[model samples]
Target: MQQGSSAHAIVVLARGRARVERSLLSSDVLPLGYRGAGDMAGESALVGMESYTENVIAMEDCDVVRVPTSTATALLRDDPALMQALVSTVLQRQAEAEERLTSLLFRPVEGRVVEFLLQAMSRWGVPDARGTVISAPITHLEIAKAIGSTRETVTVTLGVLRREGLLATAGRKLIVVDRDALAMRK
Candidate 1:
């Protein structure tokens, strides 16, 4: 959550057959695109950024961290460590958003998927008996949402990458077999 950034995000789940669209404007609690289980957004207000966003923030039975601008700024001056953590979190989130925007706008779908996998690999991968494995569970739908592609597209692309020996999904993780090849797509 960045200071002075007026965006509202709520972590909600699908109640019916409605698809959840991850945006700053949507109010319906449905899983449409990238709203995974326990997904959260940190912001104060919601402005018209995109139609995918919901105006109503449906945060029921969820922990909310609401920080007033004055309080936030005061904390920044009073607590250096807390200020650093908040700044780091906001910067990382901004970087990720920029990365996703760049991939979706300038690169091909394959490149976007590859870049996403590599980023995840760098973030969550750890050495194990089988190889460098991601310790977290990630779904194809999440990958699609991250890369601005359809779920089916992510599935097909993953299949193609797997067949080419560039990537693989083992257990709850996605593994990159050839980092060079994946980077070459960039």
Candidate 2:
């Protein structure tokens, strides 16, 4: 959905990935975070009277299930388990967002990029013979947006990481060659 629009329902990502971004101005858009399969977006609209604060853009073709606000409210009213799950999910997302903000405010570009990579690995990586591989087509532009940096900085930092034997790329996938070294930067 478009940023700043009134949202009527919660969009649950059933498959693929999406980025939640905030438009700073006409040309600047900062990515808040990402939602993969099983993640939900627009919960604030479903539970409260707030409009969507960010734009949710599909990183890849996605499958989503929309639960209207009325139905979500009704389900929450009638089902304790569903309500609990929703609360848990919202809290987790808030925590992640806070961490991102903290990193943006205090961390250097290298640290921020390393932290972002580590977090992405934990969320989406799969174990491989050599290292953990993020089996997604993530671009330098996306990484820059996510970490509040420029694409040039990300590109240079990635080259540094590659030289340090901390990262690699296989086709479109990102491989964490030395996860420990990467995590140490953060």
Candidate 3:
């Protein structure tokens, strides 16, 4: 969805798709193809772009609250809490993109799988007695797509994690067994 210059508009969609076309006019730093978060969206200087792009890319059948870019600017004008949320969201996306870039460039295939899992946990994980469980359901193919790997690779890597007790597959869900241990893989 397009935004106005002076007004902050929240774009809420029960179900739709958002393709982050371009941000050339909006920011000084021009962007390339859409990366999941920061790589394609940029930093906190462009928080609205990050939030809007992510919700468009990752979420499905979900509820989203859009704080109009203008409203967000005004709230940031006065309220520290809103400012922090905006900054954190942008930085978090940037961090996620950096981690993925590292995996894509330097890490091994297995390590990349772990990175994907950890990223998902950070975004949609729910704490449980065993560990943190992914709040949203995802498939091996989807994970493979996110990491630029094959579905077979994802399946094998997941099997290895299961053997090592890092995760457990319960029905269709992947439940994390040891978050700290998994995070320390790198």
Candidate 4:
């Protein structure tokens, strides 16, 4: 869903992955984070917002359940447990966003790139004989947006990692060839 659009429904992602982003006035889109199974979007609608505050874009094929705002609001009002769960979800996501923003502000671009790669690997990595392969086909531009850097910077950083034998490219994905060697590395 596009940012600033009227919130019609809260989308529950039942399967697959999606990217969450926010747009700046300069027409730049910044990646907020990724969402996968059991995650949700348009949650502001349930809390009585006029429009969604962020964009949620599917990165691959997905199965989503759309719950109308009215229905979700009513359900939240009626079910204490569900309300509690929603509250927890909101808080957790907020905390993660805070951490991400903080990292962008303080960490060097290369460190951010490595951290992002490691996080992606942990999230979607499949064990390979060579190393841990990230299953998703994440582009450099997407990684750049996520880590608050230019695509060129991310590409160079990845190349550096590969040269150091810490990372490897496999088709559209990447592999973490030496996890320990990359720890807190510059």
Which prediction has the highest TM-score against the true structure?
Answer: 2
Q: Write the per-residue lDDT of candidate 3 for residues 1-186, one digit (tens) a residue.
A: 332232235443334222233344656322211222222221222344443332224334434455555655676789888668767866775786676687789988788888778867876678888788886667897677666778899899899889999999778888989988988875
lDDT of 4 at 73: 88
* Residue 67 in model 3: lDDT: 53
Candidate 1: regions farther than 4 A off: 1-21, 24-75
In model 4, what are the clashing residue pairs, if there are any? none
Candidate 4 Cα misplacement greater than 4 A, ranges: none
Report lDDT (CA) for all predictions.
0.58, 0.88, 0.62, 0.89
Better of 1 and 2 by TM-score: 2
Which digits, one per residue and each the tens of the lDDT, describe model 1 over residues 107-154?
A: 988898888777767766676554467545677876776677888998
- Colliding pairs, model 3: 8-68, 8-69, 8-70, 9-68, 9-69, 10-66
lDDT of 2 by residue, 57-145 (tens): 99899999998989988989899999899889888888988988899899999999999899889989999987999876789988988
Model 2 lDDT, residue 93, Cα: 81
**Clash tally, candidates in order:** 12, 0, 6, 0
Q: What is the TM-score of candidate 3?
A: 0.62
